[model samples]
Target: MKNSQLYIITLVVLTFLGCKELEPRRPKEHSTTNFYKEVIEQNKKLNALETKRIKQTLDRDTLTTYQSSANGFWYTYINKDTVSSQTPIKGDIVTVKYNVTGLQGNQFYDYQTRDYTVDKEDFVPGLTEGIKLMKKGETITFVIPSYRAYGVTGDGSRIGINQTLRSTLTLIEIKKPNNETK
Candidate 1:
């Protein structure tokens, strides 16, 4: 009877130990609000520095004048054909010859010889909005802030954290979707 009692106690202790190991550990902090606030503050500081850098670059350039939109991106036409024509709206398939570079003049991606569709959500918000302000066969250069470009996380390769981007886009074609598809 004493041997059986010892065996039962050992079994119970082993079972409790196994259950404790199986349980998930809880984090010290339940809320990530402070972490998110820190990220936002960092982004804001980086964005301010980038904006100043872009403005300085523009000021030193004697070749072209830059302009800003309500969406907070700077743009200037390299070559413009028509300004009175219709701009590309939503559901418009646009082909653009483009080049993208960082604020420090490091080239990231370029497709000068090819064409890409202009989906509303596919491209960065700044590029999309910049394209909408251009007519067909027009070339425009623009500066996209970090928030509007890749944001804090970036594109994961050439673009780094909180990096602003500069792009030159030439709108080659614009094909609006039909009413049935819309």
Candidate 2:
């Protein structure tokens, strides 16, 4: 109908009339320099507080240190980059995916399979700490210190204390006896 056509034309004109490209904001309008500056200041303050807390909680003489706090929660590697954390409980058989490098930066193991759960008692304090913080497929880097590791006496094997071991671990699955699993 003629009336219907007129209405359609009017609708089309109204829709097109206000169509315009969006204007980009000026630098001043989009400037987030102030916001970033505030965030940086806050981060610095937090870092200072964390540093103090770590110093108070950790023993400078000991190689392996455990931290449980809101500021930071991790077992810092003392002598080497040996990963560790106490969150997963000590003496648990945890499935892990890991890549390990020696103090000389030699890649000893870089296994990436889903079947890598290690016994807590078998691993050093550092490794135990690391396993606690892992979830399925979560990768983490550990800069283990000497105390939580094979110390000055060494593990009588490949790893030693005062040695920084680098380990990137992924938790594939957690398993134990009496638990149904595939």
TM-score of each: 0.71, 0.44
What is candidate 2's CA lDDT for residue 101?
Answer: 71
Error of 2 at 167 (Å): 0.5
Report the CA-based lDDT of candidate 1 relative to the real structure: 0.81
Ten residues in sequence with the least summed lDDT for candidate 1: 173-182
lDDT of each: 0.81, 0.56
lDDT (Cα) of model 2: 0.56
Root-mean-square deviation of candidate 2: 18.3
Model 1 over residues 51-105: C-alpha lDDT tens digits?
8888998889888799988998999988887645777877787778898898767
Off by over 4 Å in 2: 1-92, 112-120
